[model samples]
Target: MSRLYGDPIEVWTRDGEPSQFVWRDRLYLVRRVLDHWVVAREWWKVREGDPGERQFWRVEASPGREAGSYELRFDTASGGWLLMRAWD
Candidate 1:
């Protein structure tokens, strides 16, 4: 089964795409982007200054050994990145 992290992460990007990230004290290079999507909540459903839109990228990443699938998120309201999920 897949796991959800929701942990804050530091990400590096190239041409507006995620290229690498540091999570839990380990660095991982994004090998391939498996999918990309966006989640946007209705305007009336969110509070002011807390817009409800997030960009998500599902990618294959590796630190050195076999790669793992990771889901990254960018919250528009806070401009912060998070490791949303992972699959081993």
Candidate 2:
């Protein structure tokens, strides 16, 4: 995965699933959610007060005719989101 590393974004959700997201001044509509999972923080490796669990979604998205697979993570503690990776 390509680490985007804290790029802020806007997401739209319906029924608690991501329907679309805005990143880099463009909107990508989610076509399908391929997978979902949660990653709990590693207490031994992570410091206290760091963001807790992360909810991840592997999705297929399209901005008009261009399409790709993307991995997105949501920080449960802070309610912040990241675009972790994109495959062209």
Candidate 3:
């Protein structure tokens, strides 16, 4: 798994699910959504003014070639997205 810490991205969602994303100037289309879940921040661990409630989608995506699995995250607090991790 390759970690992409807080890398901002642009996502296209369909029916509230992430269908594709633009990252690092490339577009990756999601082929399959393997899993989905939500992670609520622990109040004790959260600092003041920090974002919380991350929604994660584990999916198989392709950039016009062989598909790869990746974990994409949506920060509910900030309404932003991130490419969290990838399995090549």
Candidate 4:
């Protein structure tokens, strides 16, 4: 099972894709992207003509020894990255 954190993080990107991420002072390197998708904000929460969308990236990353799966979310409106969930 994955644990949801929704914690803010710092991510480094290459070619508009996450290449590395820092969470809780630890760095993890992205090995490969497992999946990608976009989610639109709830219609009621978004004003007309507002591009309220979030992008999610499922990636296999490793801090050192072995890899773990992580879901990263990018908020277009806030221009922030979050560590949405993680699996060990």
The number of the candidate with the highest lDDT is 4
lDDT of 2 by residue, 5-47 (tens): 4577788998999999998999999999999999988777555
Error of 4 at 79 (Å): 0.4
Point out where model 2 deviates above 4 Å: 1-6, 44-51
Query: Ten-residue segment with the worst summed lDDT in candidate 1?
Result: 42-51
Residue range 1-88, candidate 3, lDDT tens digits:
5756668889999999999999889999999899999998888866577757899999999889899988899987788999888887
**What is the C-alpha lDDT profile of model 4 across 1-88, one tens digit per residue?**
8999999999999998999999999999999999999999988787666688999999999999799999999998788999999997
TM-score winner among the candidates?
Answer: 4
**Cα lDDT of model 1 by residue, 1-88, tens digit:** 6999899999999988899999999999999999999889787876687768899999999999899999999988788999989998
Error of 3 at 39 (Å): 0.6
What is the full ranking by TM-score, best candidate first? 4, 1, 3, 2
Q: Once superposed on the true structure, which residue ranges of model 1 sit more than 4 Å away at CA?
A: 45-52
lDDT measured at residue 1 in model 1 versus the true structure, 0 to 100: 66
Q: How do all models score by TM-score? A: 0.88, 0.82, 0.84, 0.91
Model 2 whole-model lDDT (C-alpha atoms): 0.85
Return the TM-score for candidate 4, rounded to 2 decimals. Answer: 0.91
* Each model's Cα RMSD: 1.9, 3.2, 2.9, 1.4
